[model samples]
Target: MRHEELFYLLALQKVEGVGDIVAKKLISHCGTAENVFQTKAAQLKMIDGIGSMVLRNLKDKLVFEKAEAELRFIEKNNINWTYFGDEKYPERLKHCIDGPVLLFASGNINLNKKRIISIVGTRQITSHGTEFCKNLIAELAPLDPIIVSGFAYGVDIVAHQAALEHNLQTIGIVAHGLNQIYPKIHKRYVSKIEENGGFMTEFWSSSNPEKENFVKRNRIVAGISEATIVIESADKGGSLITANMANDYNRDVFAVPGRITDKFSQGCNNLIKTQKANLLTSAADVVYILNWNFETKAKPIQKQLFISLNNNEQKIYDYLQKTGKQLLDIIALECDFPIYKISSTLLDMELKGVIRPLPGKLFEAI
Candidate 1:
């Protein structure tokens, strides 16, 4: 982004009563933060949700001071950031109405064509929760997914460490600015995390680890991933809040079922009983529900003149061959075919002996 544009975006964020949702609405209507500032008061007043009070606050000069300071910090620290419109911004987060307008990041993080999931739980993680979290990462490592979690004590730290041990990229969604690590003792792991992955936050350099910031931070953790997994939580905790936010975003929610009597297990058990979350037993449950399969190598074969197929059918055939047997629904999604179309095509291919139908609506290329 250009410096002039970023300066206005930072200033827009500082405007009172302007939260992420409101800021996004304004930016969408005005084209850019700089344009929002350049537009006349009459034009701005015509926009929905732009009240007299908001208009009045937009004139405050102190916001520019704050923005200038933040811009200097960004330049001095070599901090990397992505605006809401930039391609580098989290794709899933763009669907969320309340996602941050500007996401500040650190480290060698990469999300290109990668699967992402957020793992969250209580700060006072038990032995059972720790073991489950680590084992889950180890099992999922082969898929090469980007593991995301809060860089906190207990379950969060354990998940990040497990991903690191497996050579998988891991991300820590921190509440505070990158200027300092919260729970300072975790400083030892900072260098290592930056090496493989890194930290992300919406907070600026002057922002401290305030009480409400953690609650606010949960939204990014929930919005950026395809699913949110709660390893363990008390009846009331931040992890549960993150799970709730994920559900609100319409993302998949998974909770590791545990003994009902345990304090930390109460939240997961309640989530399962209420049907708010899937009963997660192992990584296979995630793989099955998310419809992820092990990538298979294509078996080279010469073309057969007797077989006839359309472009869509050939694509489906190749996908089934590369991924082994898959459910009918998953086949349509992966092969980019419509459900109605895929069913008939698969039946035709099955009759042709190019593919075989298995039990439970699965199909495999023969």
Candidate 2:
């Protein structure tokens, strides 16, 4: 968004009664954030849900000072942001009524045309939960899904680490500003994630990671993805909150089954028993239920939009698409397919209209 517009947007956010929903409504009717302030109070009051209290708040001079401070901080820190109406904003999140009006970030986050899912659970993740998460991401790696988390302890860290291990993009939805990292110890992982993905938040530089902020930000974790998975959680936890928000948004939610006696497993068991989430076993569960059929014929869009490839073909395709051209041996090693199996798989993929073999044992996605 442009500077003057962003300044008015920041100012609008500071208005006591003007929240994301109200701000968006006002901006939609007024055409721009500046217009909201410039429009006559009599005319603004005529808009639906525009009450006298909000009109009074909009005239507060204190909001402009706050907006100016935030704008200065944004300029000095070189923070990148996306407006709700901008194409750069997350597509799935835009569907959410309570989605942030403005999102600020640090790092190289690419949400365009990518599969995104949020994995959340207790801060105290167990060994079994950790192993299941690692295996799940490894199997799903071929699909090139963007893994998202809250960037807290336990399951969140494990999911981020597993994504990095597979060279998959991972995003950390932080509760506080990008000025500092929360839980401080997790600082070590920040640079690595920002290299491939990045951290995103709606909070301004003045905000901190307080309990209330986290509760409010939970919606971002719940609404920003295609699905939300609970790896492990106690009967009562933040992950459960995220799952509930996901359900409210009508997004699919998945929970792993575990021993009933385990404290962490209780949450997952309750979620399944209550029919709040689907029973998740393996990565195939996601594929089957989400209807990710790779063998299905593609629709004609000149370039054959949304080509569905099997896991092996997807792995090979992702590898070749990322690296341009690669030797068969490299593709096999990189995708973890055996040498004998890769050649046959590549041949099958070629016939299925996904990839092509280059000269000198090289391969590339078609």
Per lDDT, the best of the predicted structures is 2
The lDDT for every candidate, in the order shown, is 0.87, 0.88
Give the true-structure RMSD of model 1.
9.0
Candidates' TM-scores?
Answer: 0.82, 0.81
Q: What is the TM-score of candidate 1?
A: 0.82
Give the Å shift of residue 78 in candidate 1: 0.7
lDDT of 2: 0.88
Model 2: per-residue Cα lDDT over 12-127, one tens digit each: 99999889999999999999999999999999988899999999999899999999999999999999999899999998889999999999999999998457899999999999
- Per-residue lDDT, model 1, residue 117, is 94
lDDT of 1 by residue, 110-154 (tens): 989448999999999999998899888876766678999999998
